[model samples]
Target: MYKASCSCRMLERKGILCRHIIWIYSSNGVKTIPDEYVVNRWCKDALRSKSFNCNGDPAEEIDIIDAKQISMSKMWSEVHQTVGIPMGRSKEVVDSFSSLIREFKEKLAPLGSQMSKEQEMVALIGCSTTQEVTIFPPKKSKNKGSGKRLLSSKTKAIALAMKPKRMYQNDN
Candidate 1:
């Protein structure tokens, strides 16, 4: 009988059993990993748990606005879990979702068509109107040639001063 032992770092790091421990259990005819080794966050229904407060306890007696927001969030989460994830996995599901979205947008178009003439005009004006401030090009300096000559003279002087004197070449 081969003895198997682990440093238990897997339990600390991953909240699960190490392969060494699993091997030992399998060799001893264990069928399933124990519940204590499983982390709730890794489970399928992890998000189905009750909402927790900042203090880490279950939240209670929220305001009406907060309750509505929470309900909307939960609905969105459920829809994403059920629809979005599956759609990503299957091309047929993705096509169906796309068609459903198109139909929904078409149905909603009439409801969104009640914009006032003033609102339409404002939107059109916003899109079409460009601010017409005259931007004068930068003024050309009157001393441009003098400035270039001064810069070139300074640079040439600096370069000549920095040039290393050739060794063994004495000034005659």
Candidate 2:
């Protein structure tokens, strides 16, 4: 224990402090290191430090796990056969999902076709008007007082250019 503490102190001086020095400081004794003290100190210290200098470099780069490539059938038949997961139920669920996808595609196909037709109709009736349909003036105004209220020629022209409001009485 004496030798270990000396070694830890030496490491601390050499700018190579390990968990052992923290362990020593935390326990503050020559005997056993308490787990809680070590954990608390390390956690608090870790938060302040920019990067962890401990455990230098990783051995090698490992490939990321892919669920798609991992054959569910193989996983069921051999690898995970011992587990309580019902393969039959899983298969049904997969099949059910496949059926749902198939149904969705079928429904979407008709909708797609209908949309294309509707798009064609919309193309036929685009925003641009085909024939120059001259807008005739309304024969008369329902409100007799509307004409009497004199407005500027510019205002009258703007009013004339705009689409006339239909005599639709409000229900309110």
Candidate 3:
């Protein structure tokens, strides 16, 4: 896509085609502008392209800071393989899971950063085994705490529910 865009730009610079022509066509050039090419390529099917012309080396990492731009499924499959998890019945599990985890992290980041060192460690005690912190009842203490008494699990859930994290929403 980058190649196509750049070539179009260069051609327009020399007046072989106008920016209007490129905008309308938005496809590869074989040295001629067929009027029909503009209409068909602009149709919805062209939006399904898996690759983008990022204008960098194919090996270069794509800049992905926003939740929408990032493909959770792709990243998740990679980590799943690295951890030696079997290629499961659905390879897309990790990506779906990662996206969830990423959104959760973006939400929790401010709360975590605001925490004191000790609080952060306590949160870590919960998050260490799980991607997002899910405070469970302590293993050794058999006596259950009442709902009136806030435990880590209840506290974390309440925090998450009360304020949907707004920190990363700007990426849209």
Candidate 4:
């Protein structure tokens, strides 16, 4: 004979009705939760309806690089839509996003090199001549201040003073 009211936060958070709601329904002689209460995203067959493969492509025929690029693009686009678009309105959000992208690019450089090595190996094995292989030399920055800046005179003097004394002298 007790009155119970659910906050419905479980429905909002987990996309499923809480036990309290279920109990209330059961006590009231309701056979099951209503169709409206069940979210499509929580359904087991939600992703199965989509024709996308593991690489997130609807098309069955696609190369590994193309598939990877397509999947990554889809992922980034989704992320941009969900998180970036709203947050991007603010300067702080834009700066944070730029930094995050810079760090991500730095981390992904090695993976890119690994993929290039894999492609080179595939080419060496003579799998397909249709696969175009182009090697470009690393481009040097034209900017004069591309790297570390020279230390100030005071800092250089301090560094020279901190240097360890040589134990042995070599005449040669």
Candidate 5:
């Protein structure tokens, strides 16, 4: 068994081999990554046995039954696989994929959620209140600065324009 290490210590910290170590292995005619370097935590089935709630009890597994949700989940998985291909190719390809994903998010934002912004936030944060909660507007807090009215940009611009301009008087 060939043993090698890199100064980066990527394998030590992240449980993944660094590029230098990969390069060394490739140059040494090592056709495949060693089984020892591959961490169990990164494996797809690693979390299968770790399904537990905060109280150390096994969490209830909810199976997806909704046709739309099932379809969407499958579609997302497909998209993820497709995107993974270009990730190792080039910077331009990755950037193009990023912009495409961003555009999709922007276009789908309104269609995804029917609730108001505040309600959407509450839903996203998983906040369930027993009583109906009324959210009032935030009260204005006094600043530490001495109470002086700050001049607005428009007012400052007007003040600047009203200032007397120095004209050259002909000196005989």
Candidate 6:
């Protein structure tokens, strides 16, 4: 077993090995990364199940209402993967895909707009609250070189008095 550590601590922070660790592994003639180092979420088998918990464990109980949501999510993922393969190959393909998306958007617009403003906001932000949410404006900031430089009235008058006038001469 080869033991190595990086000063960057990328593996500890992001669960991804740093270049130094990778170089050490390469120099040691390691054929594959050890299973312990590989993060489960980045693996192909991560989503083998229909849905999983945050701890990388298969959910023991699935909600009845969420069943349809999970199925729809799976179907959409498959559809996206299938349609994304031949994208950008030709102009005809791009045009056809754009028109298809537009057609679907037109058809779905009415159904989407059926929801009230509050319902739409909840759907967009994924949060619903019984209490009123008052979002105050951001604090005024004085960033360097943002607004015009303020000058005193005396300075302004001095500048105006010192201004150069253009003298035009007539050629007779």
Worst 10 residues of 3 by lDDT: 52-61
Q: Write the per-residue lDDT of candidate 2 for residues 1-172, one digit (tens) a residue.
A: 3334455464546544467665656576646444432444445545443333223443343357557546755655774543334445778776776687588779878666555665676655543333565687879758756567778999988988896777988999
My TM-score estimates for the predictions, one after another, are 0.30, 0.16, 0.17, 0.28, 0.37, 0.39
Global lDDT scores for all candidate models: 0.71, 0.57, 0.58, 0.71, 0.81, 0.81
Which candidate would rank higher by lDDT, 4 or 6? 6
Q: Candidate 1, residue 113: CA error in Å? A: 7.3
Off by over 4 Å in 3: 1-89, 114-172
The top-ranked prediction according to TM-score is: 6
lDDT of 3 by residue, 86-149 (tens): 3463658767766776997898788855767766766644332336665878678546665485
Clashing pairs in 5: none
Clashing pairs in 6: none
Q: All predictions: root-mean-square deviation over Cα?
A: 15.3, 30.8, 26.9, 26.8, 16.7, 13.8
Query: How many clashing pairs per prediction, in order?
Result: 0, 0, 2, 0, 0, 0
Residue 85 in model 3: lDDT? 47
Model 1, span 77-138: residue lDDT tens: 98677565554467887788778878987988988867787679666444433358568788
- Give candidate 1 regions above 4 Å deviation: 1-5, 42-107, 113-172
List where candidate 6 sits over 4 angstroms from the true fold. 6-15, 39-67, 70-115, 119-131, 145-172
Which scores better on lDDT, 4 or 5? 5
Q: Find the number of clashing residue pairs for candidate 6.
A: 0
Candidate 2 vs candidate 3: the TM-score winner is: 3
Once fitted onto the true fold, the runs of candidate 5 whose alpha carbons sit more than 4 angstroms away are 48-58, 63-68, 71-128, 131-172
Please give the distance, in angstroms, between residue 92's alpha carbon in candidate 1 and its true position after superposition. Answer: 20
